[model samples]
Each structure stands twice: as C-alpha cells, then as structure tokens.
Target chain A: MRTLYQFHGGVHPAEHKQESSAHPIVMAPLPTQLIVPLQQHIGQRAKPLVQIGDRVLKGQMIGQADGATSCAVHAPTSGSVSAIEMMPMPHPSSLPDLCISITPDGADEWITRTALDYQNMNPGEVRNRLRDFGLAGLGGAVFPSHVKLNPGKLDKVPTLILNGAECEPWITCDDLLMRERAAEIIAGAKIMQYLLSADAVLIGIEDNKPQAIAAMRAACAATGFEVIAVPTRYPSGGAKQLTKILTGKEPPSGGRSTDIGVQIFNVATAYSVARAVLHGEPMISRIVTVTGNVEQPRNYEVLLGTPVKELVALTGKQRNDTQSYIMGGPMMGFALPTDNVPVIKASNCLIASSPSLFPAPPPALPCIRCTQCAQACPVNLQPQDLYWFSRGREFGKAQEYNLFDCIECGCCDYVCPSHIPLVQYYRFAKSEIWAREREKQQADLARERHEFRLARIEREKKERADKLAAKTQGSKAPAANADIDPKKAAIQAAIERAKLKRSGVTPKNVENLSVETLKEIDEIEARRTQLKQAMEKQSDSPK
Target chain B: MSTALLIMIGLALFLGLVLGYAAIKFKVAESPLVQKIDAILPQTQCGQCGFPGCKPYATAIASGEADINQCPPGGEEGIHKLAELLGVDPKPLNAEHGVPKPKSVAVIDEELCIGCTLCIQACPVDAILGAAKHMHTVIAKECTGCELCIPPCPVDCIQMQVVQEDLTTWKSKYPLHEIRNV
Candidate 1:
C-alpha cells in the first residue's frame, strides 16, 4: 500500500497516559441508577418516548429522534423509569436539563437484538441502521455519524482516514482500546470503509505509541488496510489537520473532508460502528480515561449513563474542594461544573488535578514585543494583530486576519511571556459576532412579519369590500335573488336551527360572511368556544 | 625649501581652523526627553506630582529623582500611561504620597469649616480661594486632589469619595495576551 503524507504545525505536550494505557480496559460494575440526558449529540434533542413508571430493557429505544438532524437514545440497562425531569447537566453554566432517570434491574441482561448485513445493505439501509443504533462520532465533536457517512452528493469517496492520534494530554482510552482490541477497531475501520464505499483506507497513529502502531499494523496485515505512523504532534488528532496529514489534501476552512472524497472517523467510533453493525449491539457504553492527580488513574469501560462522581470515586480521588475538574484535557477541555452529569458519547477523559499541580494563572503583563506567539501559532496568523484588533473591538479587522482559523489550541497562550489569555479574547469576539448576526436575523424576521401582516390586512379589507358590494347588488336586482327562493330558504332555516342546537358554531353568522372568511372565522370561533368550555369543565372538575 | 615650509604651515593652519569651526557650529542638545515629558503632562499647573508644579515633577522624573507611582490625583491609570512612555511596568501607587480617590477635587464643608487660611497656604496649585477670616473654598477646576489641603484643615472637612461606576468607566478585563510586533 502507498504511504500517506504529513502536515505541519503541532506541539508535543507531556502525554501522562502510561497509567491508563498500561492496562486493558475493564468493564465497570453497574451502578444502581443511570441518568441519561436526551440531548447528547450535536444536533436537536431527542424526544422522550417512554414516560415515568414504564419498564425498559437494555438496548431498548427509549427516546426517539426529534428531527432530521438528531439521533435516538437507548436504554443502557434494563430498568424502570423513576422520573423524567430536569437535572444538572455537564455544562460550563451548570444548567439543568430534562433527563431520564432509571432504576437498574441489576441483572445486567440484554434485550432482544438482531444484526443486519451492513456490507450488503444499500446506502439508505446503512444510514437507517446507523440512526437506529444511535451512533455518533465518538471524536469529541459528537456529530451524528450517519450524516457524514451519507454525503449529499453521490460521488464515490476515494479514501477513509482513521484517527488514533490521541494527541491530547492524559487521554489514553483510544490507546488502551487499540492495545487490547486492535482487531475490533480494524474491523470497525472496514465497516466504515464499506459504509463510505471508499477504495482505500488509512489509519494514522502518532509514532509515540509504538505499541498501538504495532498492534494496528498486525491487525492490518490480514485486513489489507494500511496503518501509517505519523510523527507525534499535539493537534495532529484534529480531524482537519489529521486528514491533511494523511492524505496531503487541505479541506477548505469551513468544509468537511467528504468534500474532498475523504471521510475520517475515530478508532473508537469505528469500533462502535462495527459492533453495532455486526454484533447486533447498540452503543450502550464506552471506555473512559480517568487520569490526573488521582491515586489510581485507569481506563474503565463504563456504561453510557454512568455519573462522573462514580468514575472519580473508582479512581480513588477526593472530589470535594478540588482545584478543578476538566472534561477532556487541560488545554482544550471545559471546566465541568458538577460531577453528577453522566458520561455521554462525547466524553473521552476526565482530569481532576489539584490547585498545587495546576495553580491559578498569575496576573498578566503587557507584551514585550517578542515574536514567540506568532512563531507558535499553528494557523500562521499574527497573534499580535489579533490581540490588538480584538482589544479595540475591531472585530472586522480581526476577521480579516484569519482569526477563525485559530483552533484555540492554547499553544500561543502556553508559551506567551506575558501570560495573556489569548484564547478567551478570541472566544469572546467570536461569540459577540454570532450574537450580532442573530440580532440582525431577528430584526429581519420582525420586518418580514410586519410586512406580511400589513399585506394580509389589505387583502382581507379588499375582500370584505367586494363582498359588501356583491351583497348590495344581490339585494337590488331581482335576478340575483331568484336562486334564494322559498324552498331553499326553508332548507337554510332548518340548517340554522340545527346548528344553533349544536355547540360548535351558530349558523346565523355564516350567512352574513363570504364562504372563505366564514369558514376561517367559524374555525377560530369554534376553537375559542371549545377552549372556554374546556376551561369551565376543568374548573368544575375535582382537583 | 621655503615653499615646502610655507605649504606645510598652510595645511596645518587650515586643519586647525576647520576643527575649531565645526566644534563651535554643531552642538546637539543632551537629554532632550525632559521637554517631551513636560509636553505630555496635563499642564493644569495643578502641582499634583509632589514637586512645586508640573515642570518640576517632569524634571525630577527625567532626572530619576522621583518615582513614577507618586501622583495621587493622576491615579494608577495616569501612572500606567506614564510607564508606557517611560518603558517600564506601572508599579502600584505608593501609599505614602496619597491615596487615589474620585475625580472630585475638594469641597469645603462650609458649616464645619473654621474659616481658616491654613488650607490656602497648603494648596500647592493655589487652588483654594479665601482670606484670613473667611471659609476657604476650593476652586474645583484647579484643585488636583493631591490631598495637600486635607491635612492642613483644622476642622477636617475635606473628603475624597470615589466616582461611581458608569458607562465610560466599564472596561473589560484586560486581554490575556497582548502580542506586539518587534
């Protein structure tokens, strides 16, 4: 097989992965309860299909996808729903969200399942199966996998890239999985290739993990796939950078690799897909890397809905009064507000380091005109220019300088002599731009609605005038009244008496209005009367 | 022999004359930064920087006699701007000079004031307006809150309260990194 290419601009941070990667992933004991959030993936939140007090089995579909860009949720274990209400979710704000609470049956048994021949299945069938299994990109982005797999255009994909770079510090779940279940991961890669229908597949691993590279190479020997070891770099794990490194192709700034006839999936996601497609199993659980100042830093294959607090406890760490706990890695991870939020599909690692190990950053000073930041910037942007423009609220100028290209990798901030929070400023500027855009869109919507309302009112007024003129003409001319003879009047009077007897609508007003307006007004009046009647009925009923 | 002697005498005389003329014609002024510092100071003639007036303080700063953190009325904001000009970190305000307060100069609490002229003499900027037996009121525009008048007042009527947080005063926390071009 032909060798792949490489890209530039990545840093090498200390990979504290030995503790977890040293051991094979072990299954975690089932907890008594599981808190499953409906909104785990990137798109629309799933709608709950089961109510409280309903019994659910492991791998049973519990929540249905709400929209086209959503994935369904499944029960990770056999349990009964205790409550479907709001609880604290893993977010920076520590906000509450609707989640499903289930009391486990403790048997750890699987529900009925059937495997589909994903290779022979048509593209549509493959997509439907992927959606049914609720598989998303396990690569932190958590974008629904089926959407990427089924590109809108039917161009044949030439290459499929498997990412195993795990470049982030302290993340070793992928490494451990590769070391233990290399064959499974490779099988998963083939499944992805089958789904993408790519002619070639390339699995890129950093050379630092010799064990994983060797394991993958051995797995690839029989599989006829090529596993290439790229040089170790911090963000070589980023989808775009890794794709470029492996294929020597640059995906446009705001485009996907599928645009260039390439699709990239993480090793874990591929393995999960393989299991779902071949073994008739859904993505009920994933391996999580629990590392950092804990006494025992290990990767445990945990259920999907297990709480962070339990995972931390398994690592023998004191949770309370800790300096900070991060969800991914210290550089790019979000500060988790609470430990109660369950581990969703996107979570790969949890780092709970003390303040002594990672102290609060010291106060910043003015820049001393040293060009180190510019040199360290991965995107070749002028960090100094972005800083000046962002500080002055010159967001337009900052955008002109390719500010969005900055991956917020924290390399510049880490090496800055002034200890400046460069990433925060960029984030603030980006959010501000988004807020302004949303405000403009809302204003445009309001203007459109107002114009539509005025046009509607004008049309109605013209129609009412035309009707009045027609009615006057009918009353004046004898020929116009000929159709409304005594026999028809008798039938109309009978209908009116019957409508009065019924509750929905009185017929007297129907004669006064045009057919269209009468129908609309009748519907509105019926709804109002029904609502009023229902309110009265409710008031009269016992509470 | 006489012609050679005359030519050498002429060359020597010409070189000496040119050196003396150049030395007298072009003399660059040394340490011209003092005038630049004087120009940047808010020449309110407010005498807020501890020396007799703005020019004196400017001279002292240029001569390195006075530290940069002294002007209480100018406050830390002013000190930062000064440090930028001087190419140094703006240190915290020295507690001994005077504490920074609001933009307000000073107001004489007429009811409590003992109508003394001590404050008038203590005002370095001549900001106080009064005579011997009359209450000394501060010329608000001229007063620089050097707090010089506060100690001299027998009745202790002077107070330096902070200005409120308003739209203009609300600045974002400084950007984490301010990279500059070399």
Candidate 2:
C-alpha cells in the first residue's frame, strides 16, 4: 500500500460514530406525507409540472429543472400532490421555498423507469440517462451526477476517488452505506471509472471505520479497484483534502480536481450512479444518519424529501427537555428552529440533544494569541490574521489571507479558549463582501442601461432636430437638411475641395463673384436679348 | 564541620518541600469552560476566525477575552449558541456575521453555481453550497454568519437562510429559555 499523504492541520474531534455504525441501515416506515422541496439540488429552482391536486406516481418527475444547473424532483412515494406552492424548507432561517407536498397513497409504487444496456451504450449515453433521471451528488453536495461523470476531456481523466471518509463526529450514513451496500458501491465506482475513462479507481475510507473499510476492501477484491484506509481526522472527508490525501495532488487554488485531471465522487453518489445505471433507479431515496441524543440513535434508508419531523418521530420523542434540535451533526449542524421544514438533498443527520447531552456553550474571553488554533488548523492558514480582518470587516484583507479557504469545520471554534465564534466573523465578512459585490454588479448593470438610454435619447434628439429643420426649409433644397447641422457648411466645402483635388479642377471661387463681375455678366446677356426681342415685338404689335 | 553541613542541607530540602506544597495548595482551579470554547471551531487551517483554531478561540472565550459574534459562518446561530454557553446575554447576530439571512447555504444549481468555486473562494465558513463547477452545498450548520458566499455565487444561486423545521420539533415559537444543564 502507498503511504497516505497528510494535509497540514486537523483536529482529533471526539468520534460519536460508534453509536450508529454498530447498527445496520434500517428502513423507516412510510409516512402519510412526504414534503419534497422542488428546489432540492443546487441549481435553478425546479419548475412544478404537477398541480396540487394531481396524482403522481412514485419516481415521477413532479418538478422539472428550470435550467441546466437544476435537477428534476421526483415523487418518493406514489401520492397526490397536495400543494405545489412555497412551504418551509429545511434552512437556517426557516424560510419558505417551493415544495411539493405529497399525500402518499401508501402503495410506494414506482413509475416507469428506462434502463440502458451497458453492453451497447457508451459513457455519454449513461450520463444522459442519469441527467434525465435527475441524479445528483448525494453526499450532502446534491450536485448533478451526470455532469460530473462527463468531464470535457475523457482522455485526460485522472483517478476516480471515492470518498467514504465519514469524518464528522456523528455522521455514519456513508459508513452504513459501505457496510450494507459494498457491492453496489464498488459497482458504482466501476461505472464512474468507465464514465470518466479513469486510469484507476481509489476509495478513501477513514481508519476508524474498520467495518466499513473491511467491507469496501472485500467488495473491491474481485474487482481491480483499490480501497485505502486513511487516518481519522475532522473534515478529512472534505473533497479537496481527501483528494490531496489519496492522490498527493492539491487542487489548484479555486480550481477543481477535474481541472487537474481527477474527479472525486462521494461513496453514496457513486453507489447511486451504479444503481441508476444498473437497476434503473431514479435517486428517489438515500441513507440518512438519524442519530444524536435521540431515544434510538440509528441510520435509516430515508426517501428523499421526507420531512424532518417524521424522521425524528420515528426515533421516538425527545426525552421531554431536549434543549436543541440540530439538522446534521453537532459540530457542523444547524440548530433547527422547527420541525415543519422538509428535508432536501443535503439533509444528512437530524440531531436532537437535551441540554444534558449537549451542554450550552461556555462564556468567551479575549484572544491571548495562544496560537493553539494555528496548531490545530489542517490547511496551514493563519486563522488569527483572518479573524482580525474579519472582525474589522476587512473582507478584502480576510480574503487575501485565504478566508475562502476556511472550511468552517468548527475546529477553530471548538479549540478556542476565548469561546469566540471565529467562523461567524469570517462568514460575516465573506457575506458582506459578496453582498457588496452583488450590489456593485447590479449598480454596474443599471449604469450601463442608463448610459445606453442617454445615448439613445441623444441620438433621437439629433435626428428629430434634423427632420424639423428639413421641414421648415424646403425639403427639396440641397441645403435644407444642412440647416440643422452646425458643421454642415464646413463639411460641404471639404467635400468640394476633395472633388476639385481628385479631378484637378478649380474649386468654385465664390469669392471671385464680386459686384462688378455680377453686373457685367447680367448686362451682356440683357443687351443681346433686348435686340432680338425688340425686332420680334415690333412685328407682333403691327400684326 | 560535616555535621553542620548535613544540618544545612536538611534545612534547605525541608524549605523546598514546604514551598512546593504551598504552591500546589495555592493553585486556583482552571475554569472548566476554557477547554470547551476550543472544541467548536471548524479548524480549517484557514485562519479566517481571528484566532488560530478552536482552542485559541476557546481560551479567549473562557478568559472573557472574545465576543461571541465574530464567526461569519456561525452567524446568528453560533452567536446565540456561544452567548447561551457563556451565560452572556444574547445580542442580535452581530452584523459582522454578515446579515443573518435565511439559513440557506450556497447550492450550486449544478447548472448555475458554475463550480468556478468563486462561491467556494467567497465562502468564509467554507459552507458554500458547491464544488469546482460541480454542485456544492453549504453544510448548513458549519456556515458562519459571513455571507462571503454571495460573491462567488456567479449565478446568484447561493441563498442564506435558517434550516427547515417540522411539527414534531417545530414549535410555532421557541419555548422560553429555562437553563437546564441536563
């Protein structure tokens, strides 16, 4: 086995994973209602093609992707669309979002799904099928899987890295997946390898999850794919970090693994890809880790878009005095405001802990420059400088210190003696900068529009003035249009000068037409006309 | 002469023992909390959090050295949690955690979030919603109060808001605060 490449800094957080990994993936009994957000994936908000009263078959595309960046929303269970309007989404603000409220018929029947034989179909076809099925990255990313599968240049594809490093303290869904569905996961890796035309397939699992690692290894034994165990570290599961650990390649700053010819897919997403390609599943359900201070901490095969309340209830009620309910794990999870919100693609763990189990935070003090955070950082960034800039709202400075590089893994906050919410400050600075930039972009667009409008108006005014002057003077007159032009006379003289130069002809010397010159020409013509007229008039008058 | 030297040595050893004991006896109990503040930070090695990582922040918090509202990703929630933990009165999420938007993390519309990871670079808490041009998501809980995510959202797909709730746990309004250690 090749030696694992370690990143700079990471914290050894308490692993609460044993509580759930001990158990197998259990299926939650069907709920009466499934509230699926139409905009579950990170993309264009899905457009609802089904009405509130319409009946939908399981796995049917209820909502279509509004644009390329979006995904299709499918019915997890056969049901009637209760509402196609905005309802509360599982977010930190508890905001209302577009959702499909399905009243399950309880049949759990699947709609018609298409399957392509791998024997004949190419990688592109496989990708298109997944795209049509609305498959996405299921490991909390919820990215469209089809797009990731089809890198622009297949020939330059790097190793296909399967991430099974469930490094968060309490999340065991991926571990459970590796244990229960190892074959499927390996199959998925093979499919990804085929899709990307990867040279080799590497699956990275944390050493702590021995069972999962063993299972994955066993599954990969027959196949040529290799599964490697990595030392457990908080956020070792991060894509960039995992990529670096597995391949010894650092994704370029603000660049992707694909940019360097590598593509990393979460174990779950790989499994889904395999199943979707092999079994024709449409990503209707996923394994969720429903643990944390609940009565029964377990992992469940939850259908996509199930409401959090139902899932929590399945684990049994909070023991009366649960102080906080978090969605995801403790370190990186949000304290849920209410349970009415529906789980979306990224919803992984729903944690409800009593005050006793999860105590309230301690009071904070000022920074003593202990440099402990620096010691703990995995990315080798100077968090103190970033914090200084962030607190001062110097977003530009914070960014210069690689503010965007901070992963919010809670290691700094977790290790801080001062109890300062350092991540919050960075988040604030980043958001403020983004908001300001957005405002600037909007302002710039508005300015462009305003300038264009002014120019248009000026042009129209000039044209209107020209037309009015032409009308006032005789329209047929050569100089009529020139009356409105301030420089028309100069322009005409220039044209005459050019013509004279081209033809070698004397330019019309209007200056030579003096009073005497005009009088002589007029008198000479008058005398000749008078003599001829006098003879004719005399004859006519006699007649 | 030998006896006198022995006596002096004995006396010196006795005094050293007594001083050590006195020092140990006089030692003050370290605050239990100082250790906790260190444990909650993301420890990204990306030092956006003015402190080094979780431990330094913890030390500062325990010493009454740091405010509870510096983290941008933690936003109002982190501030509230810190305030609750420290027994300090919770203030509105410091405007500095960026405006406390709906707990929406950046979600790469897969089709939109352009995976340019401009959002990823913009994300102070690394809670942006995508990967490089692929879809990314904000680990909702990990996001700090900072909206640094909004800038790299090339497609304007990232939205910050609160996490969702349901009936089992969703109370129309939160219950009054009754501090219960258990």
Q: Which prediction has the highest DockQ against the true structure?
A: 1
lDDT of 1 at A418: 82
Error of 1 at A349 (Å): 0.3
Q: What TM-score does chain B alone reach in each candidate, compared with the true chain B?
A: 0.58, 0.44
**Residue-level error in angstroms, candidate 1, position A481:** 9.4
The alpha-carbon RMSD over the true interface for every model, in angstroms, is 18.6, 15.9
In terms of docking quality, model 1 is incorrect
For candidate 2, the C-alpha RMSD (Å) to the true structure equals: 23.7
Candidate 1 per-residue lDDT over residues A1-543, each given as its tens digit: 555665555567777778677777888888778988887888888899999999899998888877778888889999899999888777655566778988998876687778787767787888877887888888788888888787566656888889999888889988888888899898888877777778898888888799999999998996778888887877888888788788788877666688788888899998898888878788889989988778878899988888888878887747555766798877788778788888889889888877875777777777676867787766677888887888777777888888888888887787788888877777667766664454345334433433354466689999999999987876677665686775578799999988778977666755767788978988999999999999999999999
Error of model 2, residue A180, in angstroms: 0.8
Error of 1 at A457 (Å): 1.9
- Candidate 1: RMSD to truth: 22.5
Please list all clashing residue pairs in model 1, or write none if there are none. Answer: A420-B176, A420-B177, A421-B176
DockQ of structure 2: 0.01
